[model samples]
Target: MQETHDINIIAWWGALLSTFLALVKLWELWNDRFRIDIGYNFTGAPDIGNEIFVRNLSSKPIILSYWELLYGSGKWPFRKLEEIESPGPDACDIRIDPHSSKTFTFAEENYFDWGLKTLKGRKIYMRLYVAGRRPVVKKLYG
Candidate 1:
């Protein structure tokens, strides 16, 4: 009888330890999932054409997969101003370290080629997406 009771107690302790270990592991995994910091600056319109520079200032590296530019206009339906192709493998993988910044030059010619006109004096919105993470959205009126 005593031996049986000892075995039961050992089994109970083992189950409890396993549960605790699993909880700790879950917490650690949740903590390391993903973290990001984003910053936006509206550089004045480009002199040569209607272009702007979007700067990313953050400590951790953010993998920007793609971005979209939209104009806020009141009408039957909102229109898409421009859709810039995300610089893929050829484009440098942006990794901004602490107190570091990266500049993305958006030119007007590219938009014109895509049948988009000047965005001057228009409210443009930018949406940036990173893989396996939430998108960082911003609105700029320049």
Candidate 2:
């Protein structure tokens, strides 16, 4: 009887350890998934011509301060680190909450006109920089 009780105890401990390990792995997976997801949409308007709509689809918030738009003309968004590291907010830098979206209205300004002219009949791409995350380089194709 004593030997059977020892076996039962060992089996119980083995199952408990397995369950704890599984829980730890699940927690790690959940933590790994904690990051911002970004998206974009283009809307045409009679006045603005085109609106660049940005969306944050993740469970976390995103700071646009690290964002830089590389025009198809090979224009540099910032020349140096000091320029890129925005200490304060700019027109482009805004905080986006989770599952929220931002719209740049009146995008038909000179910048948009230039963008259209430059991107005409060509592919589009973007360079994204977020703090504590790897740079996301993606090609934008419609």
The residue pairs that clash in candidate 1, if any, are none
**What ranges in model 2 sit over 4 Å off?**
1-6, 9-17, 20-28, 31-38, 43-46, 71-93, 110-121
Pairs clashing within candidate 2 = none
lDDT of 2 by residue, 67-140 (tens): 54433323358322212112235445578787787654434342333245545544444556655668764444
TM-score of 1: 0.45
Candidate 1: residue 16 lDDT (0-100): 100
Candidate 2 to truth, TM:
0.53
What candidate 1 gets wrong by more than 4 Å, as runs, is 39-62, 69-91, 97-125, 131-142
Top TM-score prediction, candidate number: 2
Most accurate candidate by lDDT: 1
lDDT of 2: 0.54
lDDT of 1 by residue, 1-142 (tens): 9999999999999999999999999987776544443344433443333343444443345566666656644433664455443454465445544444455555554332212365545545666676557776566553
Give candidate 1's error at residue 93 in angstroms. Answer: 2.3
